[model samples]
Target chain A: MTTIFGVPITALYGQLVVGLVNGCFYAMLSLGLSIIFGMLDIVNFAHGAFYMLGAVLTWFAFTQFGISYWWALLLVPLVLAAAGAIIERSLLRRLYRLDPIYGLLFTFGLALVLEGLLRYKYGVSGLPYSIPDNLQGVFNLGFMFLPKYRAWVVIAALLVSLTTWLIIEKTSLGAYLRAATENPALVGAFGINVPAMTTITYAVGVALAGLAGVLAAPATQISPLMGSNLIIVVFAVVVIGGMGSILGSIVTGLGLGLIEGLTKVFYPQASSTMVFFIMAIVLLVRPAGLFGRER
Target chain B: MPNIVKYGGYSLLLLAGILAPLVIYPVFLMKALCFALFACAFNLLLGYTGLLSFGHAAFFGTAGYIAGYLIKQSSFGPGLGILSGTLAAGALGLVVGNLVIRRQGIYFSMITLALAQLIYFLYLQASFTGGEDGLQAIPRGRLFWFINLENDLTLYYVVLAIFLGGTLLVYRTIHSPFGQVLKAIRENEARAISLGYDVNRYKLMAFVLSATLSGLAGATKALVFTFVTLTDAHWHTSGDVVLMSLLGGMGSVSGPIVGAFSIVTLENELSDKVGSFVTVIIGAIFMVCVLVFRSGIVGEVSTLYRRVVGQREQ
Candidate 1:
């Protein structure tokens, strides 16, 4: 039995694994938030609700139509993308030209309404989306018994986040998005359909949250409230990462998740507030966030 | 409204307020009055200062807990408890406002919200709050070392007096030179700064003032209800006040009072019948208010009144 810093090493490794798993979800959610904020200039307060919808609708598909986890993973994001499109077309489209606070307020209302409706249909006692038979085994990673499902979750989340980062930062379409973010009017002047582009960008951003939801279903209990509490923490992440950078969100989220995990290992009570404690400190030190560029 | 109509309307409203306890349930009115005070305090920042402090319920609910605990443990008059709660809230505002005012616009809202949730988590975990059971059966105590507050009617008038005092304080602040500076900062911060105002200090002061008043409301509510709970400090309460201020009309003195009364009545009406549907209903109301009723009930009525007055002049 090996020990590090006079503490059991296996326990440390286990907490680190859990932290990485938590980090995956945080990274995915904050990634979506950063994308929407960068392109559409709206905070997407309903991002958490959309994440909950992903879990709920995926669970819905499973129970109603016997859709497997694999299929629902593909289907849920598309379904939520359509919903996002509709929301953008109906409500959010009117808000882009106004004060951004109006956008924040609009999404806040949408979140409460959506969560309330879900709770109305399915009582607060969360439904379970169990691990598939294939993903149930464990891997003895030398130090700890790592669950196979959790590894898949981390891989899948990282892949999704990486692909999103590449699509927005590397490809030609990515160039347009980056350009669009800087000056929409200028981008529009170049024969680009900025409105349609803005709408699609928002949908994609929401789809990323939906993808995160599907990934999180087996990790946590599938509940209508899955997103509400998590969203505030994500908001703190967005604040700490600043709204200016995409990579900032992904990196900060993962880092904080690890920090929070370490706090759990040392002092369980402070685990809940550790990220926020970091958030306050970060704001005091760098008002624009770690990777934020002063605009 | 003309001077005659304005003064007459105010007199009539006060008269109705004085008589409301006779007609309406005193407990219900006390509830409304407390919420009305909370909303108005919230309005002072949002309506007048143009800083949307989303964490106000932290002050409102924390004060309730403090006041309730003091009244339960000590033999001090309720006035002392309320005062201490209010000052403590002001101190909290000073700290929170320090962190939050560093960011502007949407970030300001998010910071306030995050900090409020931090407080909520603290209250949730702290033993002093009594957790799920809450601080129950708090004493109303003597209002001024003389008047007994155990009686329902006495408590109602006490709440009313506090409500009036809080409203008048906000009213005067809105009309004062400091308020003018705050309003100038709200309308255009850069312009206000260019004109040589220490905008941060003004904003922080308004935030503290709003918080202290909200604490006053919460303290009164605890004494009135004879208990305090986490619900007082919850984000939902913060959202409710935002809804009230917006629905009644932001940037107006009387808007939050109307908004608070209507929402409390609406909650009273709907909670029994629909239960869970109340959230959905409130959300829908929020959507509708933001979408079309940006001016709010009182704001629109005043606009109409002004239009009619202009027509008469023409």
Candidate 2:
């Protein structure tokens, strides 16, 4: 029954939870984008399309094969990664030698094709996916009620992001990936198959998007257009976080998400554009981004 | 000898374009001309300056709204309204360009897009834009004192004049020393900076010039159609312009014009038959253009022409 800053405390807390949930998705997707941009110097504009693909693919699996969310959590990323590898090998490989702008254009085209095809088959309307039975209940957390599904999403996403960070920063494979990103030709001369590594890196980045998409299906509407909206925001997050650092993207994404949530509770009109407002301010102050090193 | 013949061929093609509206519907031709100008203006930055802005819709659509509002609310004629609208867009570009020009490559594109979206949200909330319905029922108004733009023919000639003026201006800019410096920066910024050129200033000038021309086109378009809507200001409009520029060929002067006309004509003819499939076809064309026709229609033709001339000379 307490009020904080002229609004009900419970309502404020509820929005904060929603904000955190949204942030989790932003962190995951922007982290993937940062990794891809850092390594390839190519902005993967079709990242949203891949995310949409993940949701649609999950829906298809559920309807046809009765695959539950548990199985989807395992299978979706692998499928998306395989698709990403094929796209890189077949289409993206040709663009590596050209200007980075061409990579953006090519991916933009790919996104349109993917979204259009999905719209053609499924229409613009979304399909509903239920949360698994085990996570159907809600918990009273003293301050506010929390949905079990949302809590699960936050924990799972954090774990996934942490694991990705550890693998890339700590492991030998991660070392090799980092080294290849810095100097592909030198890495290749040292007996690393740099081209194959590049392909796999793109796949891993795309797989992260797919994984996020699968997590999102139960929380949000499973629609083709969903990814398009989120992708633009994620781009802002990536810019704010600096495209070179994975941890920067994660922290920025989550932080911005909470800020947006707070705005919704305090001032509803600015909520939609709060993230962009911050982005503009960040751009003016530090063109290289908060966490990015200047080129 | 062959060079003269090629010049003659190009002149004839220009003559054909000028005379086409007489045979075809003038309204449709006017729409195509507006879009052609818009695409050309966009190409000035992307092709010549090597800055790919993803928020051009902000200028185009905002100008449309401003022009629409003036014609609807004030007694100002279409000419003054369009001029004011263009100035508004140019001023906006100056501010936005200053902020965004500091970043290069993908970051620049992202900044433009996000800023444009912010403008879009502003328009959505502002009472002057009429919210969702937009500024509707805008008057065509008279051009100067005598010419009535209510007639389709009068509007067509007015649009033609604007398009011609814009094209010539762009051509002059391209041939200017400033444009040469821009190209140098585009090819290699480090080299240009080392050569003591202020690359940021050149980029900002180009951005403002492109935005002004695009705004002129959009303002004229609002007068011609007598309507301004939120659709014009959306990110999709920005994407459409980019697609047109890319489809035509980035570096060539006449490419975007050709691309704009062809795309508008194709969409008009096919939309009734295919419905939403137009998006798919456009996307396919984008893919095909990026993958197979990197040089674009005009670029390819010029290359072929040069090759043929060389063979003949030999």
Local lDDT at A281 for model 2: 89
Give the TM-score of chain B in candidate 1: 0.98
Most accurate candidate by lDDT: 2
What is candidate 1's lDDT per residue for B1-314, written digit by digit as tens? 46997899899999999999998999999999999999999998888888887789999998999988888898757999999888888889999988998988888888888889899889989998898779998888787777889888888888899999999999999999999998999899999999999999999999999999999999889999989999899888988999999899986888999999999999999999988878888888888887888889999998998899899999
Model 2 regions lying over 4 Å from their true place: B1-11
**Looking at model 2 chain B, which ten-residue stretch has the lowest summed lDDT?**
B13-22
lDDT of 2 at B226: 86
Residues B1-314 of candidate 2: C-alpha lDDT, one tens digit per residue? 46998699878977976798789999899999999999999999999988999999999998999888987898878888999999999999998999899799888998898888888888998899998998889988778789988999878888988999998899899999998998998899999999999889899999999999999999988988888888889887898899888888887789999889888999899999988777788888888888889888888888898899899989
> In terms of docking quality, how is candidate 2 classified?
medium
TM-scores vs. true structure, each candidate: 0.98, 0.98
